[model samples]
Target chain A: MQRYKCIVAYDGTGFAGYQVQPGKRTVQLEIEQALSKIHKGDSVRIAASGRTDAGVHARGQVVHFDSKLQIPGERFKKALNAMLPRDISILDASPVDMDFHARFTSVRKEYRYRISLSEERDPFLRDYAYHYPYPLNLEAMKEAAQYLKGTHDFTSFCSAKTEVVDKVRTVEEIIFNTSDDELVIQFIGNGFLYNMVRIMTGTLLEVGSGKKAPAEMETILAARDRIQAGKTAPGHGLYLWKVDYA
Target chain B: MQRYKCIVAYDGTGFAGYQVQPGKRTVQLEIEQALSKIHKGDSVRIAASGRTDAGVHARGQVVHFDSKLQIPGERFKKALNAMLPRDISILDASPVDMDFHARFTSVRKEYRYRISLSEERDPFLRDYAYHYPYPLNLEAMKEAAQYLKGTHDFTSFCSAKTEVVDKVRTVEEIIFNTSDDELVIQFIGNGFLYNMVRIMTGTLLEVGSGKKAPAEMETILAARDRIQAGKTAPGHGLYLWKVDYA
Candidate 1:
């Protein structure tokens, strides 16, 4: 058997999530079904770098699987894409070493959140961005993001339902970019807990809107409680941008 | 009665076209229905800068209508947007002079066509762009576009079913831009004949793909025969980008 690595992109609008549920539609389920067709009725399971919540898009999601089929990487990509639905696409596929695990070997992950600052809703971008009509204080948001750039116990920023014991994670960088009608925030981290990025985005938005002070980030992190953080941002605006393996 | 001028944007995925057609769901029909609801069952008719073909999107489409309501401009915008569907949006609305018209008074119109040059299809932009996986010669396309600019009888580039006798139109400019995976073509002109832009785009694609020579544009124009022009491109990739009047 040969291990194959693939980079995938998906709209995520109609998907339940990346993981497979009993009867729900998911990215993993769709990919597995396509692979099963290629394997001629035999089931094929794949492992992804991480799980994304329902309605969360991905531009560079990474996954891996082992297969006995001897097909060229390009042919595998073409065959999988031809069978997959329009919303899900395999951007690339390649054979990898047996030791290369998609989830365990990942060193970094990047995520982006898009917020539309236009007072009027844009018809085309309705599904891709979170529309916030109120004005934002960019300076305050930038200052708050500084506090979130380093390693910390991100328990306050993670979902309370998370079963993971180790809440400590290293955030390499947090970049905030603004355009005429939208604000984009990118988060790069060694590892992220469940709902960590969305909670952090929500907290930054509160700071940007002047509802909370920039210094409050320190207090939120120190509390180590989910109640100390702001509300979780909607899933639709989040994107699993890229995954790095080294 | 006051004349209201508004700039609109729409997804155009579910719309038949910009014009009103019986038993067909069109952009004009939706706007008129919304206006009727606002005017207490009194149907209101609007005149747009021009009609867009079926499945063609619009970002800055201009329209004008006569209304007896005494609401403020901002209120009118908010009211209309509140009633419009998710696929359509009223970006701006204001009272215009009695003599102003949406169609005849317009001096310039801009249209854009998007082509995806990526070998793999992009799921997110499926409805917004044309997937042309073939390689294109940008320089060749640019050379051909120059011959298309300026005043000319566009009869060969227009639909034969059109009833308009005056086919002479001035194309101000044709801008070709390329990104990593897509090519965008913008056409700024005083006016366009029915299906003229699509036919021109198709002809340019032919030139870019080395299927036709650039010098053939002059011969096609001199012919004044619709059959001499290249095939019309699909409508979904076309956008009524903007309508300008001074």
Candidate 2:
């Protein structure tokens, strides 16, 4: 058996997210079906670094699978691309050690959220950006984002539906950037919980809008209650940017 | 009556183009509907810098309309934006001279054609760009584009379905640029013929693929037949960048 690793990109629209659901379309099921076709009369299963929620996009997602076929590393990418849907693309394919699992090997992950801070909605960017007509105070949001960095129990920012037993996670960096008409929030961490990034974006928005203070982050963190955080931002504006292995 | 000139942007995916079509959605129809709603019982008609064909997008399309409503120019923009659909936007609105007409007063028009040269289709950009996987010779295409500049009889390049009596037109500038995995073809002209931009893009792609030479432009021009030109590029890739008046 040969283990292969692949980097993938996908527009998460028209999908029920990355996991396999009984009645809905999924990125994993589509890729597996394509792999089955390429492998000729045999079924193939693959695992990804993480399970992104519905409507969330990805620019640098990684996955791995073991196949009995002895296809060259280069041919693997080309064949998969030909069989995959237009929305999903395999950027690269390479042979990996048998023990290198996509989920187990991933050590760090990065996500970026986009907010359009303009009064008028942009027609071209309607689907990809979250539109907020109200002006935001960037200084306050930046100060609040700084408090989100470093290791902490992010229970208050995670969704109530999360099944993870432990809520402790290390957020290595949180950066805020602004353009003429848009605001970008970037977060890098060892891992994330269900809807954690969206929740963080909403909380930061409240800070920027003067509804919350930057120092309130500590109190929210200690509460360990989902209701202590702000509402979750829309999934469309979130992008899975990168996955790192140490 | 006050004449207002407005700069507009739209995603042409849902419209039958810029012009009003019977029983079909058009950018003009959407804007006019919004104006009527905001003006309250006043049915305002709009005239645009150019009547873009079906499926052609715009970034800086100029339009003018007259209304008797007593409101500030900036407020009109805000009102129209509130009433317009998600696919259309009024970027700016201002009072203009009574003699101004968006079509007749326009002095220059610029357009861009986007072609994706990647091996895999971009599902996110599928509706916004044309996908061509073959390797293109950008230098050769650029050289061929230069020959299209200056005044020339574009009868060969113009679509035969056109209703205009004149086929002669002057091209002020034509440029072809290639980035990491995309090709952009820009054109500036006094006016364009029906289906002209798409035809030029198609002919240039032929040149880039080595199917045609730079000198063939002169021959194609001399042929005075649309069939002699290359295939027409897809409509989704073309965008009306701007209209200039002096």
Candidate 3:
């Protein structure tokens, strides 16, 4: 048996999410189905670096699978891409050591959220960005983002649906960038909890819109309660930008 | 009665084309349908700057329509946008002089063709760019593009299906730009014939790939025959970037 690692990119528009759920279309199910076909009816399971919510796109999602097939590593990319739908593509594929775990070995992950401030909706970017017609105070948002950069208990930013007790995580960097009509926020961290990034984004947006003060981010973090943070931003605006492993 | 000029944008993935057919989903049909909805069953027609082929996107397509609805120009934009499908959007709308015509009054039009030379297909840009997975000489393509600029009889570059006899058209500019993995070619001209831009892109790509010499563009133009040109590029890679009227 041989283990293979691959970097994947997907549009995520039509996918239920990254995980496999019975009767639901998902990125994992599609990739497994394609892999099963290659394995001649044998089931193939893949482990991903992380799970993305529905409508969340990925630019460099990493995954690993063990297989007995003797085909070359480069050929797997071509074969899998040919079978995969247009929205999902395997960017790179290579054999990895048997001990390499896609999820456990990841050192850092980066996510980007795009918010379009254009008064008019952009037809092309409708699926890619969250369109917020209201004016936002960029300086206020940047000030709030600074508070989020560092190790903290992110329970207030996490989804209540998760049962994970260890809500502490280290956010290494928070980058805020602006163009003419869009605000891009990038988060680099050791890991993110369920809906953590989206909830954080919502909180920053509220600060930017004057609904909440920049200092409120610290209060929300200190509360360690989900209700203390703002609402979860829509998943369509979120992208798993990149993942790092060592 | 009022004449309204609007700048429209569309993904064009699900659209048959810009023109309305008996039983087809088209940009014009969708706009007219939305207008008719606003007019309470009174049929409405819109004249576009030009027709785009099926699968061709648009960023700044100009159109004019006569309406009896006594709504303000800004309100018209909102109402029309609400009625139109997600794929199409009215970027801007305003009342125009009754004498203004979308097609006849147009002085220049710009079309963009994107060619992705990356070996891996980009899932995000799958619908917007053509994945040509081949080495291309960018310098050769730019040199060939220069030969096609300016006033010329472009019979060899036009589609054979076109019935328009006067093939003499002035190409104002040809801009060749490159990023890390994509080549963007923009053609600005007074007008384009049926599939003219696609043919020009294909011919230039041929020059870039070393399949045809850069100097051959001049010979192909002088031939005045459609058979002398390269294959027509796919319509999906084309975009009606902008239209200007004076």
Say which candidate scores most in lDDT.
1
Candidate 1 vs candidate 3: the TM-score winner is 3
Candidate 2 at B125: error in angstroms? 2.0
Sorting all predicted structures by TM-score, with the top scorer first, yields 3, 1, 2
Per-residue lDDT of model 2, residues A118-218, tens digit only: 77678987877789878688888888888888888999999989899899999999888789888888999999999999999999999989999999998
List, residue by residue over A1-246, the lDDT tens digit for candidate 1.
999999999998899999999999999999999999999999999999999999999999999999998789999999999999989999999999999999999999999999999999899888889889898999999999999889999999999999999999999989988899999999999999999999999999999888999999999999999999999999989999999999
User: Residues B53-143, candidate 2, lDDT per residue (tens digit)?
Assistant: 7777998999999988767878988888888998898888999888998999988999999999887667777778899999888888888
Q: Across residues B1-246, which tens digit of lDDT does each residue of candidate 3 receive? A: 899999999998889999999899999999999999999999999999999988999999999999887678789999999999989999999999899999999999999998888999899888899999998888998889889999999999999999999999999899988899988999999999999999999999899889999999999999999999999999889999999887
Q: What is the lDDT for A55 in model 3?
A: 97
- Recovered native contacts in candidate 1, as a fraction? 0.74
Q: What is the TM-score of chain B alone in each candidate?
A: 0.99, 0.97, 0.98
Please provide, for model 3 over A1-246, each residue's C-alpha lDDT reduced to its tens digit, 9 standing for 90 to 100. Answer: 999999999998999999999999999999999999999999999999999989999999999999998678789999999999999999999999998998999999999999999999899889899999898998998899888989999999999999889999999988988899998999999999999999999999999899999988999999999999998999999999899998
DockQ for model 3 equals: 0.83
Question: Which is better, 1 or 2, measured by TM-score?
Answer: 1
Which runs in model 1 stand beyond 4 Å of their true positions? none
Residue pairs in candidate 3 whose N, alpha carbon or C atoms collide under 3 angstroms: none
Supply the TM-score for candidate 3: 0.97
Best by TM-score: 3
**For model 2, how many clashes?**
0
